[model samples]
Target chain A: MKKLINDKERFLSDMLDGLKQRDPHIEIIEDTVVVRKEKKSSGVALVSGGGSGHEPAHAGYVSQGMLDGAVCGEVFTSPTPDKVLAAIKAVDNGDGVLLIIKNYSGDVMNFEMAQEMAEAEGHHVASVVVRDDVAIDNEEQRRGVAGTVVVHKYAGYLAEQGASLDDIVKKVKEMMSTLYSIGMAIHPCLVPTTGEYGFDLAEDEMEIGIGIHGEKGISREKSASVDKIVNRLLDELFKHTDSSRLIVMVNGMGATPESELSIVTKYVMEALDDRGITVSKLLVGDYMTALDMQGFSLTILDEDDEVLEALDADTGSKYFK
Target chain B: MKKLINDKERFLSDMLDGLKQRDPHIEIIEDTVVVRKEKKSSGVALVSGGGSGHEPAHAGYVSQGMLDGAVCGEVFTSPTPDKVLAAIKAVDNGDGVLLIIKNYSGDVMNFEMAQEMAEAEGHHVASVVVRDDVAIDNEEQRRGVAGTVVVHKYAGYLAEQGASLDDIVKKVKEMMSTLYSIGMAIHPCLVPTTGEYGFDLAEDEMEIGIGIHGEKGISREKSASVDKIVNRLLDELFKHTDSSRLIVMVNGMGATPESELSIVTKYVMEALDDRGITVSKLLVGDYMTALDMQGFSLTILDEDDEVLEALDADTGSKYFK
Candidate 1:
């Protein structure tokens, strides 16, 4: 592997160490859970987690006005139920806690187990599963990708506003229902455990409708222009929703450069404008990544003024802020 | 080229379009300049610029408390003297403007000519040329790299505090002298104009003491572990300075992932601790880039509490905030 890492065994722990070193306001618990240094005493604390590779997601979002804690698993793997339960116990204040789960089977099952375990321990816990990827035809099989961060932002905003756990879960589910994300990966991400890529693509070819975990995409084709790829992605996205306005996130799937992301944004925004759809708020960066995958994802969140406000609300997370 | 560009000729303009679309408070002038929508009239306006591909540097820093204007050239090329002159004129309030020039020969010569032209037009202007790289032995010939952003942050904070133009220049020059940086590239960055990488490295090799513009480095070796590579870079950097405290930036040279950047930060912070150097403020992200180079640079500024506070100050720029 061409990755800058020590032992593959220590990748997660070492990464968290690096993350903690950069942000003084974060603390790692038992080396698997990241919590805000000063946990708020009231309201529903937001918690999210998944595999370790998609950085600045669950952990970077752990802060005030965002997630209170993130329970990280190893790369391309789900955290244990014990770790998730520990994360819940760390950040759950008097009101309760909400867990945001991406729709991968492993993550969903593990986070749900933790939720049940936490609830049995007399802590009120609610969960919202994000299945926002429209690439798959079956809703039950759709996998969450970059749009999960938007769910975190909106839920964290509502939770910070002192909404009840039930209300936060309801609002988050509503948002998730309307949100859609689709990715195109030109290269597969490396798996540390195997020291190999999850998949492969030719130097001059591309895959459309890819997922975060390097699952088989909808189709493969010779590398087309970015504008054409964007049009294809957006055409798929626009089919499922009639919302006239959207909150957009043009997220890099790890190794894509900001220059390319900016170019992608230009084309995406221009295409949307040409279609008479207004983008209320747009975020362009590498918020959710697939290790070193060379691709980008477009996440469209159907939004009104309130949803846009929620997404734009102030957050203490270094990445989101 | 594996770039997400519509036309190579329109790359820079399209990028500015995307940037402006994302942030409504920024505006483009003369097709190659970025300026704050509402220039503050009472203080020294900060302006900086160079080549294009370094996204979120000169242009992204153009905001209320950071930079008032950024004059951009085409990819990897310096802006023309007339464009620099236009930028100075655009942001120069009655209080004069400060030009932050990276120490590339083309940039220094062009910006100096612009300064002369602006002064000839009766506009007071002062320029602080940054040459913070420690790799080059000849001080007069060293090129500015990522450390230029630190100069910008510190000087911008001081300018926002209403410091005199002379005082700002003096303090900035002092900081510039104390600042040191060095980078290692795992792969060469592709230049849009040439549609090719500036240099080549084998898959298992790396270049040490590299420049942002793809100038050859001091040495090349088989790709050592990140920790060893970081130690070598810091070894060279420490020989030139004896700063007790540092404000460090672990900057990605374009396509480096945040995960790898975090790993680099872990080793760097550990090394600094081993050397008894205290790091007050450490930022780990892609601030300055060399197109899509898969490498990183370490920038250290000798800073006390005041300088740290200056770096942590609020800015209207979306990237820095």
Candidate 2:
């Protein structure tokens, strides 16, 4: 595989080393967990994490006004329960901790197990699962994708405001109900460890409703124009929410150029405008990604005063801006 | 090529449409120039631009403390002199304007023409050309790459501080002397308009010192590990600057994954540490891109007290952080 890496075994550790070095405010612990250098003395701590490839998601969100810690796993793999527990313990300062778990089977299981272990140690911990990906017909089977970044931002904002763990969990869960995301990929990414493409695609084909881990999407069809592809994705999302105003995120699935994302953004905004919907906030760039997949995802969240306030609030996150 | 675009002819306009939609603070004028919605009233205005594919370079840097305006050209083509003059007229206040031009034959010529036109129109204009790319042996012919962003940030900071146009030009010219940059590409990028790859590269080969416009580099060799590639690039940069402390920017060439960039970052920091050099600032991610090219560039600038203060200054820029 043509990737800028050394031994596959060292990918996670080496990436974390670079993260810590770039931001002095970020501290690495247990070789897999990243937390704030200065712990908040009070307030419910926010912690989130998953596989390593969807960078700037969990780790890049770590800061005072965002996530307090992130538990990282190997590329496209779930972190161990011990690592998650370490992040919870490292950030919790008595007000309790909130774990933001993306709705993937492995991630949900591991994060839940860590929550149990933390509670067994007498720390109050609450968890919220983000199943915002609308690709799957069955809601429970949906895979959380770029919408998870919005979860971190909103929940982290609540935590920074000194909200109780239970309140933060309740609000985040409420917000997830209004969040929906779907992605399409023209090229599949190679799994660094396996040294193989996640899936094969003919030159003229594209995958719709693809997952962030490079999983096969709901369907494969002939490539189409940006407007057609965006209309299809938004058609799926429109079925889930009828909100007149929304907060939109045009996220790139690694390797997609920012120029393309901006082009995608234009179509998305035009599509929404035609439907007489207003976009309250728009974020266009890569937030979550599949190693080197080339595609884009569109996420829409129902606009609310609290949601807008949280997203607009100041944050120390180096990536969110 | 599998790209998310509607019409090749509408590439520049569509991208700018999305940019304006996302940030209401930005205004699109003359069909090609991007200026701040609220222009500065007194301080010298900073205006820069070139080709359209380098997202967030000239346009994304437009804000209160970064750039006052950006004149966008067609994909991989320099902006017309009329567009450059339009940008100058749009952002120029009574304090005059400063143009940051990257050292490309077409760009320098067009921006110089625009400068003369603006001067004849009675607007005081100053221009600085950045020749920071160390890929070419001759300093005069070096192409400005990602290091142009540093020039934007540093000079923008000075402009925001109310520095005189002449002083800003003088300081920026001095700063350019100590800046160095180099890039390498593994896979060639397909220029949308041309419908062809910029250069040819085998699966096992890579190009060193590749230009942002997809121009061929100085050498081609078998792809190596991330550490080795970074060392080779740094070896060239080390010959130019002997500064003990430096500000480093690890820029992805459009399609490189952030995980890979972080891994590259790890090796860069480690190499500098082993060499007894200290990194005072670190900026990573896709700051300057080459339209989905698979590679990255390293930019290093000498660290000075004034440079640090400018780099650390706050800005309304959405991408610089």
Candidate 3:
């Protein structure tokens, strides 16, 4: 797989043209598939995206407190609805837009066909659909990986501080009923147009709920140790956590190690401080990655403290502050 | 080789106790290594560190514009000069301390014995050392990986605007004569307490330069093509580049993939736009990583335009904004 790409679907548009030629106030939108392009305001507007092998998912998280537009789909595929109706008409703003979707099934039927073509272009749209991954315990075919990095940072930080689209889809399904994310792969993520590899796991094995386009994992076993893989992903994120409004992410299935995500955030913070559970915000790294693919993933949310102070706000990223 | 560690010589002091419990403005001293007690301002006090397997090197880069103190060591081991003289006496003030250090040999004789014991406790110490690893081009052991992340982001933005100690050691040795860095590797980088993994290479092998602790690599081959390893790391970073101030970076040798660092920044931006070069800031993902080691590494850095707008600042890290 000798790559340096010029074509191969312009690897995420030449890595978003080297991120808008290294940030000239970032704005990218050729045929809409996002990373915020401007002309946004009036209210609502928080369109997210998926699949482009999650490089800075939903477009390096759009910006200005998170997402205003993003609809890519060619790394794990699922963005057609005319590129989510050109990212809901380039971040709609006649006051109404909120797409944050992630519950797979072709990203919930292509964000419900771009929310019925942005309600036939009359704007006003709404959709939350996150089904955060609890591996698989019949949350009706549970899937959607890494809770779309916390629904693109709390519905793009409440649609950039002007929340609307029904209060940003009612606080993103009220933080997706206490969000939960689970992952683990240990290795298997190559998909540069079938350079093969999307599932393997052998040197000691591991699988858990794998599926960030590499799918495959209900269990696989053997890989053990990192507190037995964070106590089997905190026993399915504390069996769908509810109160104890926590927010711990120990991600990194993009070939793990920020010193093994601080040793899986010290065993998911000692299994959420042995259940007395307090954790307010703590994302260990490789936010929802799965490309180089080794393994890691745990994502509990159930947060109050306003989605844990907007997931400890302040962000830019070379590895999350 | 499985670890979530409780011991491995207390994995860098339980990762500075989960990085000071995920930031209570980080302050950890215990088994005496150091990392300041956050907001203890007293100006010109920018110390730095080495080794602790470089996770967020120099302790998640200290903070408040950046780095007042940081000394870590064990894992690649180097910290003792009484822990860089307790990080230059926990960030000395009266406008003096600097340190930075990275040209290894036990981090230049333990930051030159913590700058002669902070000039025999009178302070006003100075140091600099970062020999910007151009893959050890002999002339002396030549080490110091990933141009020490641009000398801790330009010596932590010039010791957060105070800049003294011989003008932050003459602009960190003019950023080590316009830095160069190189790296590669593919497999071989374990050492989290001898979990082994140093030089083995094979599944399509690779290796070139490689050092950030899993050391060993001047050149090994057979895994080419990320444009022949970005044309042999831009032919050893344009051999001491003067291609009119380049700045590149690619990085991610901690299990590569920001889509293979955008295919090594698309053949390092078509070999620095076919050598007419003029980068002015580029940086790709996984800066200074080696832990989950798969491979990558480019780092250029020539600089100008006020050090390329502080390497085009604005960072928090979803893998370098």
Candidate 4:
């Protein structure tokens, strides 16, 4: 595996060190959680996290108007409850704290454990699960993908607006209902710890509906043109939402070139325009990424004026913009 | 080779279409150039462009405080003089325009042609060539690589401050003198049009001092750990500058993961700290990229108070932040 790393065991800590060094707005705590250096001190603090590989997701969102703290774990591994509790304690103000947990089995369990621990300590904490990935037919099995970032933005904006933790949870849950995401991969990523490829694929094949951690997708087929692939993902996504106006995110799996992402973005816009769906806001880039996975994901959120205002609100995030 | 493209011939145009659709801040002109939608009406307009593969370079930098226009060519091919002229005319609002060209033979020839054409039409235009790559010992042969984006930010800031085209040119040239960059690649990228790899590498080999176009670098050696590789590149870059305070950018060639880039940023910070050099500012991510190349480049600029202010200035660019 050709990867730029040293001592695979130190990957997470090393990455976090680099992150804190690059941005002054965030500081690392408990050697695993990243929190805003400037505490909110008044409004409800928004906290989110999961595995570490999907970067700029949990930690990258830890900025003034976004996440207050992000509890990071090893690559594709959930953080312990203690680490999550540390993040809660570090960011929670008098207003309370909200946890934006992606709907992964490991993540949900650990974050909930942390919530219970924090509540036992007299901290008021509410948690919301983002199950936006539409690859699976069962809602319970849906895995949150790139759409989780929108949850961060919305929840962060609400918290910044002085919304109660309960109100932020309610609004974020409402937004999550309309969020849908689907991904396809041309090549699978190699997990650094095990030195294993997430999955195997032939040169001319692609996997549709792949998850961020290289989980198996819904189908594997001969690779087609960009439009066909984008349309296929959109078809699955359209079934989950009927909203005419939407916020679209074209997120790259770790290794896809920006040029190719732009091509994917072009076809996505064209496909949406054909369906008469108006894209109220569009973001195209690698926001949440799998480690060295060569693919892209399409995420769409039903748009309302409030959500648009929140997304457009200014933030101190170095990555979100 | 696997790629997410339709007709290789339409790569540039399709990517441009997507870019224009995704961002409202910039508009496409002459079917090849990207210019600001809200053009600056009374200040010197900064314009930059070159080949299409290195994304978020010239085009992504087109925004309120950055380049007023970006002329894009076919992948790895210099844009025609006509497109550059169109960008120059479209953005020049009588206060004159400045061209920021990278140091490539084809690019220098084409942009100069455009400048001559614009000058003949009674428009004031000044141009600066960035030769920051330290891989090549000959000053004239040094390629621009990723440091050109710094030029855009600096020049853009000056233009926003109402600096004359001549003044912008002089200051940018001065800044360019202090800029230095070096890169290393683990694997070469595939060219979409020709369906060929830029270069061949053995399983455990890497190329050092590679250019953005996958051009031959200074050396090829057995792959090593991230820190050693980073130190090797830094050694070459440090030979060109001796400033105690610096601004650093660790840029990814298209396919490197954000996780690896963070690790690189960590080592870079440590190396600078050990040398007693203070990093005034640091940017870590894929800023300028070669299409699907798996590697990174490090760029350091000798920083002064004026340079720091310019780098910190805000812009409407979707990619720069």
Candidate 5:
């Protein structure tokens, strides 16, 4: 539990400073508290941001092929509306801006408030609230999890190509229609300050549909067979899906091994094949992580070839392909 | 424990197969079973490889800015010399080749024997064997760990620019003299087969100088404060380093968290700063991870701005920059 931070309070600032040093193309605005890099097209800009624990997500994706700006909140917490609005405005070209947000209540509300404020400032803006987690039962209220990655990809891809606000919103709506994700945890990850676990599970057990913030999953069980566990997840998820072509992901929760993830991927691929779903693209590694939680998530998105090609595009991060 | 692999034996092959699918640039030779990209570099082929568990060490570095060829082996086992030599010959461009190696006994013997074989075959090949583990002893016989990253950067930078074998060797000698690394583990990692742990340690205790292959380390003690652990590791590592101007790394052993790694990084920066070292650069995350192992390591390289600039360069893998 010993850590190497200078101070728990300053860790965010110091880390951001270090990140800025490595990529001078990024502009860290203290006034707005947003991270921005120049974009080539003067079009509708895409803004995506949330907690800081998920490295290479909002920030790492802020490159030429992805988001124009990313706003990072304290770990697991949503960025304030002020920061979100600032990021939206910073990257907003005359065309408009699109906010891709997770479906968490706080995150959705904050991004919505930012959208309202941006509209007040005469900026054309729309939002795509991503609720991709398939682990929960009440479809109307299921929590968002790793499926946010799809939003980062589609939203950013659309915005980078000068898609209009309406076009971007339509694209994100299409994306959300096809995306589904479910995750399990073997252990609770700690917030840096508390060093207290965010959640708990027995050493031999796992909880499905666990929230990244360590929210209790819908169900718990002694860790079952890989095929059984993957099937259990697929049973809940695939029954609701409407398509057969998919982009499958077996993501690590920060602490699982890549080798182990590939192992999980084997079962996932087999399960998808058994169900007659054609996996057009695949990613089996830590794309979105939950601090130090020891487990992995299965994200399945039934998408067309365009989305699959975008997902398969070259990336710049340690975990992503 | 519930991995989805077909069989533990074919796990590595499956992973490589997936990697090949995603990266059409890399080619696997059936004749010698060597994996490499078809980047037609007429310069000497820069080849490096080791066990499979320590992902990305050799393969991930095979993009345009990095290595030319990489040979893969089973988990925690060195690739045969024939495979290594085959990779060398396949990529050899008459200018001679540079084999960058970690200091594991298996890796050293295999690569050394390959070097002799390559030289005997009229290839002007030289090598830079890296032994940067500061955990145990900074002697000739000590093992190597995360400092292989440093070697990867310099060796790849030189090799990419078509540096001759002699030039790359001389450069690595100068660079090797200035880098050192030390690591500690909280729990032993589970190997695929037999599900056996690398070593045994009490839950409340930790082992310092942990080898990536789970070799015995230097110190075993009750977990201490992050600052204390950093100081202890620094006392041993800086004993033979000029880390006054350093590229500091706080790397996780697979299962450690960025939350935990950042904590360790704070202590690392403090310990080095207290000793009057000017922090030239910092990389905090999982670079070289032991498969599903719980622990962290600290690597310091006395680097100039040139080295930092090169390190900042992009690689095709997930986690650089």
Candidate 6:
């Protein structure tokens, strides 16, 4: 696969070790759980995690104003319930713990199992599944993509503010409902274990509405121009939500250059301007990635004043800031 | 080339427009200059620039605690002396201005010309050329690479500290001497104008000691394991200089995934550990990049107390913080 890893099975561990070396504010718990070094005495601890291929997503979010802990699993695989429970136990201050689960079957199941296990031990635990992908017709099947980062920011802000678990979960659920995302993948990513791409497409073709895990996209089409691609993604996103003031994120699906992300963001901004939408806050970077997938995703959040304040809150998470 | 650019000719401008849209603290001047919105009232204005393709290096560093302004030219081409002069005029408050030029023939000549012009226009100006590339045997031919960011951080901190132009330039020159960098490119990047890869390498080949502008490296070798490649690079870097305390950066060359960077960094840390070199501060990510080049560069600075303090200083530059 021409990957820069020592061993395919040890890729996630090596990555986490590297991250811990760079960021002193975080430490590893039970080998798979990454948590803040200075735990809060009492507050709703925010925890989010999934597969490990998404750089700076779940682990990078483990900081002061963002996630308290992130339980990392194998690449494109969910962490076991024991690992998630360990993360919850490590970061739960005294109030409670909230797990921000992305709407993937394995992730939802494992996180829910962990939540139940934690609750059985007399600890307050709540879960919110983020399903912001707009391409899927059925809400139950909609996959959470890069838009989950928005939920993390808002919910983490509330947790840092000493909000109750119920309050943070309720707010995050509302934010998830308002958020919408869809992506186009120019190329599929390689899986380290198999040393093969998850899928393949013709050079002139792209997978529209692709999930972050290299899952089957909604459709395959001839790769169009950047503007046309942006228009298509935005058309679907705008159909799901509309607002004069909004918060937006142009997320990379890994391997995409920052310059290209900026280009995509430029057209997305132009598209929003055409609709007379005022972008209150915008984030342009790889908050969530898909393991070297060459494409970008557009995320729009219909945020209120409180949500905006939370999004702007101070977070030690370098990815968020 | 699968670049997300609108017009090949307008790529740089479009990228700048995208940057301005995301960062409200930065504004463009004279169409080719990016300056901080609020200029330093009376301090040494730090100016640095090269080609346009290095995203976030010269421009993204223009913040309160970083460069006062960045002069941008065409892709992989140096800016005209007039553009550099305009940036100097725009940001020079009352104290003076200092130019941080990477040791490229075009950049050195153009920035020197601009310095002379600015001097003639009654502005105190000085320049320092950073030639930290260690792969080249001849000192005159050594090209500046990712280590220049270390110079920016130190010089920008000094500028923000209200140090005089002479003082900032002196300290930066000393820093430049202690820095050394080496890089490897697995794949060549496409130039926007030509729409062709700058250089070609076989599927099993890699170019070692490559410059940021896709210049020829010291040698081509069979693409070996990541550990073997990192060892070779580190062997050269360590041969140039060794110290008990150092600051290191593992910079991605645009198209390399963040996970791979982390993987590279993992081995880097282990290599340092084996050598018993303690890294005081570590910076990892795409600080300076060639246009979508799939590789990475390692920069090691034998940093003393002052340089370490400056590296840790607060800067409005998002890439740094």
Give the chain A TM-score for each candidate.
0.98, 0.98, 0.37, 0.98, 0.92, 0.98
What is the descending lDDT order? 2, 4, 1, 6, 5, 3
lDDT of 3 at B301: 70
User: In model 5, what lDDT does residue A274 have?
Assistant: 91
CA displacement after TM-score superposition, residue B61 of candidate 6 (Å) = 0.6
lDDT of 2 by residue, A181-261 (tens): 999999999898998999999988999999999899999999998999999999999999889999999999989998888
Model 6 error, position A254 (Å):
1.6
lDDT of 5 by residue, A233-263 (tens): 8887876786788787777888777666655
DockQ score of candidate 2? Answer: 0.78
* Best lDDT among the predictions, by candidate number: 2
Task: Supply fnat for every model shown.
Answer: 0.62, 0.71, 0.36, 0.79, 0.31, 0.52
Q: List the residue pairs that clash in candidate 4.
A: none
Checking candidate 2 for backbone clashes, the offending pairs are none
DockQ of each: 0.67, 0.78, 0.14, 0.79, 0.35, 0.65
Which of 2 and 3 is the better model by lDDT?
2
Q: lDDT by residue for model 2 over B164-186, one digit each (tens)?
A: 99999999988988999999998
Q: Report the error of model 3 at residue A157, Å.
A: 33
Instruction: List chain B TM-scores, each candidate.
Output: 0.98, 0.98, 0.37, 0.98, 0.92, 0.98
lDDT of 4 by residue, B1-321 (tens): 589997899999999898888777788988999998987889998888999899877788888888899999999999999989999999999999999999999999999999999999999998999998999999998898899998888898998898888888889988888999999999898899989899999979999999998687889999998889988998998888788999999999999988888888899899889888998899887889999999999999987777888888998887776
Better candidate number, 1 or 3, judged by TM-score: 1
* Candidate 4 interface CA RMSD, Å: 1.1
lDDT value, residue B53 of candidate 2: 86
lDDT of 3: 0.71
Using DockQ as the yardstick, the better of models 2 and 6 is 2
Instruction: Write model 6 residue lDDT over A53-125, tens digit each, in one string.
Output: 8888889889888888999999999999999999888887779999999998999999999999999998899
Model 4 reaches what TM-score against the true structure? 0.98
Counted clashes in each candidate structure = 0, 0, 13, 0, 14, 0
**Model 5 CA lDDT for position B187:** 74
